[model samples]
Target: MILPETTTVAADEWVSQHRYLRDSGLRFFDLLVAVDLGDQVTEVVTHVMSADATRRAMSRIEVRREERIPSLVEVFPAAAWHEREAHDENGVEFAGNGDLRVLITAADPPPLQRSAALEPRVDKAWPGLYEPGAVSGATRRRRPKPVPGVNEEWINGGRQ
Candidate 1:
């Protein structure tokens, strides 16, 4: 199996780098996405391939959570949908996409961001008072644990 060639570029050079790749024969736009890197930064990645499928490449740009990267819609029109999905899910903006309407959940802080609190998973009361799978009203055997990746203070109504 062949792996896609990966290139990490600065946010300002994103469009230009992709344009170079497209011009070099990786003209097939595969996908675009965002990965939440905890509370400080997010990585936006794009993949493109040659027409014959023999060559592929991935481009990545890491930016602060609030920063916006240039859009690739002018270079690859199909990037609009993927960009919108990345925007809605991770709060990363694709500047100049023009059609970045929400493609998924409308939750604040973007559901996929590492700092986002899963309210439903943390707020709902479990039937077992003491522990999961235990009988209701059972005596406490241990301290209740907070949901993974959710701040305990936040779940308790205190912001940290």
Candidate 2:
């Protein structure tokens, strides 16, 4: 069967929505995570289940890349670790979480971010650097594509 739909909410309403979920019988905190939607937005996902473990629901909230969100540690203390992982992996900042320290990579860029920003490989075609389905596996570079950081214009408007 298809999974139940997840409810999406604004970042500001996340904590309250989660509290509502708990009051509505979804008292089990399954997980809390985040997805990198480029540098502009990050989608945080939350899953909760009924105390009887028979019902469940998922919720999502989007936060601007440079913004902070309140932590749910006060509600579900177990969420501290999951939120930390999201912060470590996707560069999300939970406002009330005292431990936003990088859990995995303390120095490297977020693992979920675009690899192109960190590694320049014009010689080797990456998945999104080219048109979709243009190259299945590995293909020789036929032309010199614009590099993102070499020229400021490339990053601004040169690529287009």
Candidate 3:
């Protein structure tokens, strides 16, 4: 009954961690996408599930400004489309993913990632940072919880 935890992982470790999850009981691939954090960091998120879909965990990889993340398609083929979406929306570059082609019709700025060029990413602030307001309007915070007994080194797709 536990929702997939959002575990922050490094770009290099993404594949390995996901591979480990696949090798383990969580063999079901769920989803993958990214959020433009607007601080030179795009938070890439992916989730996997147990065969029954009851047990799952989310993995978030913080891709720093100008950093290229490795592709997860090698481990989870489903990542292909998700990575394309991230690239089309947020301009994130998944290094090994060959299909980084624009997923949708978009301009140079991309639809979802449009901070004023003159201002720093932090100063410009990502539009829709608050869905409607600071309170009940949106999920303004990360409520990610870790899976029990899953260590950071491997569980949730971090480190090891």
lDDT of each: 0.81, 0.74, 0.73
RMSD (Cα, Å) for all candidates, in order, is 4.4, 7.4, 14.4
Best-fitting candidate, scored by TM-score: 1
lDDT of 1: 0.81
Q: Which stretches of candidate 2 lie over 4 Å from their true place?
A: 115-160
TM-score of 2: 0.70
**Going through the candidates in order, what is the number of backbone clashes in each?**
0, 0, 0
- Measured by lDDT, the strongest candidate is 1
Off by over 4 Å in 1: 124-150, 154-160
Tell me the lDDT of model 2 at 91: 80
Off by over 4 Å in 3: 114-160
lDDT of 1 at 59: 87
Sort the candidates on TM-score, descending order.
Answer: 1, 2, 3
